[model samples]
Target: MSSKINAALGREIRDSLREMRIQLSTLNHRVGSRLGLKDADLDCLDLINRAGPISPGALARRAGLHPATVTGILDRLERGGWVARERDPADRRAVVVRPVQERAADVLHLYAGMNRGIARICADYDEAELRVVADFLRRTAEAGRQATEEL
Candidate 1:
């Protein structure tokens, strides 16, 4: 691609990413409300679910929240029956947070529509194209993490 074309493509990609972020934030807000969770609490829950048995400190760092804030979120989540804090088997002194499997289905149900839409969108692309898109998304996510850390 020519430099001019590449520049235009970059601009378009940036705009598309911004729009996607806004839409995802809105969706998260709705989901969080339905689950009786604050947006930050829901985000922490997601990080915990995906990371599987993570320490409070690790979750705070991953979620870009302070340790105290994470503790508060954990308290709410526990009271809401969304997650559990258990002693780490490897290190009895430490604690690890895990999602309560029984409630996982509720969260999944809320996101099912979006997941199906994403799957349908992916169906339009060939394997190679899908690979390219996946690679781009991974790189972009890493870039976002780095940017967040820098702030």
Candidate 2:
């Protein structure tokens, strides 16, 4: 009975995750379409913007993507003049990927708009109501960390 209960709970969790992803994805698609960038491309741009100049492999690790996938994304951004790869001066052997002039404002604005949109949405709710959602997500993420630690 306990095993069955656990199995049922697992399925419920899976369904909930799927629903959350679908809704979140729909929102991102709407935003990304307005901005004209691919989902994968956004992750790549964000890594450079957030992590400073990092090698392709390091960027992939930071973004939780494979190197080949990151390479393809960079290719698009490079061709669009949105990103540039430069040789690491200290490590002369390594090439670091970074956003060049063309993409800087666009890349930064993407995150800024999302934050502003979220803030605007949160404004509709009372502070107490917003706090519950924030606390729940934090706890859920912490629980995920604990689960991963056990493995």
Q: Give the per-residue lDDT digits (tens) of candidate 2, residues 48-142.
A: 87786789998887667878998998998788787889999889888998778666776557558667988899999998999997997798878
How many clashes show up in model 2? Answer: 0
In the range 66-136, model 1's lDDT, one tens digit per residue, is 99999999999999999999999999999999999999999999999999999999999999999999999
Q: Which ten residues in a row have the lowest lDDT in candidate 1?
A: 43-52
Best by lDDT: 1
lDDT of 2 at 143: 81
How much is the lDDT of residue 141 in candidate 2?
77
Off by over 4 Å in 2: 1-20, 107-113, 121-151
Candidate 1 lDDT score relative to the true structure: 0.96
